[model samples]
Target: MTLYHFGNCVALVYVPYYLAYKHSGLSEYGAFWKCVQAGMIYMFTQLIKMMVLATFFPDNVEEFGSYLIGDFFKYTVDIADLVGLHFVLDGIPGKGHSKVLTAGIGWATAEVILSRALLLWVGARGAEFDWIYIQKCLESNILLVQHIATATLIWLRSRHNLNNNLKTVVTILLVLSCYKSLLFESLIHILKLGTWLGLVVKGAFTLAYGLFSLSIYAGMAELMGIY
Candidate 1:
């Protein structure tokens, strides 16, 4: 679990660095600060959520009224935080802005809610949810779907010749999403490896996945005319 958390943090930090380097030539300090800002936002929102969850729910077990309230509170707070960040940092369009940013946030939120609901439904069957197993196999599939959706959106945006910065932002998001998927897959596979041979196989899988993600990102960047 510690490894998983550390890997996620590393990937999140690296993503903005990569984007800044490839597109804007921002210094490491600039990229790092941006990542820090985003990290703070994420952590603050999650901390508030944890406090509320602890105070109100106190237990993982779900009662009808409590469960609904918890879910509603969690969803509302998360959405509000995300939208507030988006508006404050990115700003609403006057007349010529790609709606892709809004769409991306909406899609990501929907995906998270759907995934959690699916897990909850499965858990209600009295079966334990195997996070490692699900991350190994299912998470990649979900990420691939997201990438395809994002790529299609980028293509549509290009057809209209929207701002290059908008397309760059979308490509960066796609890369980050793919990187996260690969990182989760790596962590899960590493946890599952049993012997030297299994370790070798897991390492190979991680490398392949990483390379594939990089290729996807490079392609997306090229398509967005970032490089």
Candidate 2:
């Protein structure tokens, strides 16, 4: 039954992605190759981010201020993800919507494979069942929402026709999206929240961010007259 368990976990992890690609008109756009390209860029960007973190933010930090400094620099490195997303957006050949969808899905999928798949493969298939694997699957879904919203915000930020005020709002939201996990980590540490509570907070924040991004997108289109 371990295999069956594994299958269920896999389905929970991947089915949303498949439905998103199929139902969001990415299938009609034939964006598979573009998604692949974006995934490749994601991998490369992560590799560079890791290298930078390792080289600059070595783990010997002991002082509280050092920890703060280290974390600050590390978060700065995460901004590279936006640079990578921009590359993915510019590199893909399609309209804005297709490019955003392809880049976001591809980036999120690559993240799941690289970060979570092996843990599930080993843990979910083990004889002892763990709710952690299921939790991980739910986290994967959250990541999808966050990535897609961030992608839309980034695309919106790129539009020169968007007024400075809207662009500034998008930029602030984009930064918040990018630093989401760090903010959550800080909150969890400060409040000493349990794992389940932390997950609940993350889910709520992601939902709010997604809705806010959609609202901004609608406002942007209405104002600029183009996506």
Candidate 3:
């Protein structure tokens, strides 16, 4: 679950950065470097998510399921925890934890707005913002979204036709369906290993999954001509 969460985070951050860099008219190597920087920014964001989760919702962490709402809440809490941890970990008396708590609140507000904006981008053609509809859309379309976004960005960069929307959509759905049924399901069950491995195995798998997901996006980008 953690791995899946991490992978999604990496894809979210890296894909955008890659697109931005590609569009910026940067050389291939330069764009790759910029993407690397973006990955670092994403790592910082993930750290923020972890810190916030640890500080605020420490007790409810395990209960948080692997869904869009869960991701939103987790990331929001992470941002908050980053702020609070900065001050509290510094050991500056009462001012220590104060900063983090204050930061967490601010982070939550910002993220809520940003999340809405992202959803709008993803569901721009749709008319209402029903949570249930959005959830269904996410479950059904996330893989497609990832592939199309990556492919489109690359194709545009390479001055390609960008006329393969149908193919991209179909491919994503098929891949995600298989992924959910096989790999994702198996990975979820593997979480049981946490007991014997002291949770470190789970954390490692989460990170690896995140990286692998990012690579998939990268592959899509390359195939679509963005890379």
- Per-candidate Cα RMSD to the true structure, in Å, reads 13.0, 1.7, 19.7
Instruction: Count clashing residue pairs per candidate.
Output: 0, 0, 13
Give the per-residue lDDT of model 3 (tens digit) for 87-172: 32232222211222222222322333344445544453344333443333333223223322332222222233334764464345
lDDT of each: 0.43, 0.86, 0.38
Q: Where's the lowest-lDDT run of ten residues in candidate 3?
A: 92-101
Better of 1 and 2 by TM-score: 2
Give per-residue CA lDDT, model 1, range 1-227, as digits (tens). 54454344334423433442445333322333443343354445556766766776546536636654544444444443344344323432311112332333333333344444454334423334343433433343333334234533444334445457656665565444434434444555668754444434544554554455445445655766654
TM-score of each: 0.32, 0.93, 0.24
Q: Tell how far residue 68 is off in model 1, in angstroms.
A: 6.9
Clashes of 1: 0
User: Which stretches in model 3 have alpha-carbon errors above 4 Å?
Assistant: 1-32, 55-227
Badly placed stretches (over 4 Å) of model 1 are 1-30, 65-74, 87-227
> Candidate 1 versus the native: TM-score?
0.32
TM-score of 3: 0.24
lDDT at position 59, candidate 2: 80
Considering only N, C-alpha and C atoms within 3 Å, which residue pairs clash in candidate 2?
A: none
